[model samples]
Target: MQNIIEVKDLRKEFKSHSSRSGLKGAFRDLLTRNYKVIPAVNDISFTVTKGEMVGYIGENGAGKSTSIKMLTGILNPTSGSVIVNGMNPHKEREKFVRTIGVVFGQRSNLWWDIAVQESFRLLKKVYNVPDDVYKDHMNHVIESLDIAPLLDKPVRKLSLGQRMRCELAAALLHNPPLLFLDEPTIGLDVLVKLKIREFLKEMNKKYETTVLLTTHDLTDIEALCERVVMLDEGKIIYDGKLAKLRSNWGEGKQIEFQFADIHVKKETLDPLLADLDAAWTPGNQKNVWIANVRNDEHIISEVIGRVVASNKITDLKVHEISIEDIIRNIYEEGIING
Candidate 1:
């Protein structure tokens, strides 16, 4: 597949001023003028192929939004190059706008007082879409998103889920080949989220739309993205296939066991299970230990047997490590480990 978006050595920085505490300090600082340069995006580079769905993920303040802004031509990079569909985004912004669509979860693009269908018609005129093309695309999106019932509802009167469906329809009214989705499922209930995800999958298959999504929901990443790009402290910490990330960085399963009459002390068991790096915590009730095992299923069962021999065992439950937990661990441990 050919590359639709290419970002090279992108860098964006901001000069932040320091505030003084006391009146005297403030007066002196105003005269001296103290400021620090903060690098929000530092020499990061990546490519998105045509018709690929890529997940852009990171913790807060990790520069995800800044990078998206640069890609969408909303903000110019301090240094480096961005080419979207064979055009320089910053230099040919007018052409770029007609080629891509963007939706921000924190904001709305539709007219607040207008009906859902009214907003779509207005966008058709604004984008200068041909009447036949607009009708064809609108019918497809309306049926796919199941927003036919919502066409007459005012934007303010519709629920968040309804409004989001309308927003997606409005963004695609121009028939852009590329789409940028920023937390599209934010604040939506599970049922509504599932509906949105299904609609997006249909769109991808039908239009071959190349989508770049930024979301905190792991479920969204798991369901929609084939590859994930993780950023930390303004740099790419992990990139590649999602399965590879899980195999390499995803720790392992967590096993929790309960005993009827457990009386063993931590000092005694700690040395016994020295080979396995496990943390034991007492459960909410009595005679139970919740153990977190790291990539050693055999050792977990062995330890359980040993515990059973010494104490009366009741029940055991094992759970696979979730992607959310794996990413959280990566952030807590920092990007590199010795």
Candidate 2:
């Protein structure tokens, strides 16, 4: 497979003026000149092949937006290189952008005063899409996104979810080969998100479009992407299969047991709990105990056995670490390697 997006040693920087905290310092600083260089994207390199959906994820101020801007030719990198579809995004701006579509979650790409279908028609004219091709893409987007009813309504009058559906449709009207979605599912209801995810999956499957999705929502990553590229402090940290990341950095399992007796003696359970090396905590109920067991299956089994033997377990439930928790651990621990 050919790579559609290639970035090598990509870097971006900005100059900041030094500012003083207090009134006196602020007045004195006006007489002097000083500047600091901040690196927003530091030596990051990765590639996305045709027809692959990859997640580019990070916490706030982690250079995710900066990298995306550079990739989309909105902002030029301070140094190094970026190439998409055999052309330099910044140098060949007009031609490069035609091959890709971008959607920012908080921004509106549609004309607010126009009806939804009018917006689509405007995009059709802007992209010079043929009559047959426009109809084909429009039909697919409307059916896939369930936005047929929204077409006649004004964009400003639509709800957030409805507007989002229309925005996605407008972006795809050109039938671009590459899609760049930044937080597309942010602030959407679960049902709307599910619809968008399904549409994206079908778009990739049926049209062979390459996608680069940037989102804080791990559920999006888990459901839509096979590979992920993680950035931290303006540098590339981990880029690999999403499953491998879960297996390597996944959090410990959780086991909750409900006992018959509410007044379980602390001392009586100390010795039994001491053998399990797990982080135990009190559950919501008085007769409940929750333990964060190790990732190892054997240890989890042994810990459960010990709990069951000591107390009459009325109910039990076990769960693996959630993707959100795993991502939290990654940000907290600053784990750079998988």
Give all candidates' CA lDDT scores: 0.85, 0.89
For every candidate in turn, the CA RMSD to the true structure comes to 3.0, 2.8
Off by over 4 Å in 1: 258-272, 281-290, 294-297, 306-315, 336-338
User: For model 1, what is the C-alpha lDDT against the true structure?
Assistant: 0.85
C-alpha TM-score for every candidate: 0.89, 0.90
Per-residue CA lDDT of candidate 2, range 1-338, in tens? 89999999999999999887789878878898568999999999899999999999988999999999999999998999999988899999999988998899999889999899988888888889999988877897899899999999999999999988888888888989999999998899999999999999999999899999999998999999999999999988889998888888664788888889998755666677686767666778888877777778889888888889878989999988777777778888888867
Off by over 4 Å in 2: 21-24, 257-272, 281-290, 295-298, 308-315
Tell me, by lDDT, which candidate is best. 2
- How far off is residue 84 in model 2, in Å? 1.3
lDDT of 1 by residue, 126-182 (tens): 899999998888898899888999999889998988888888888888978899999
Model 1 residue 285 CA deviation in Å? 9.0
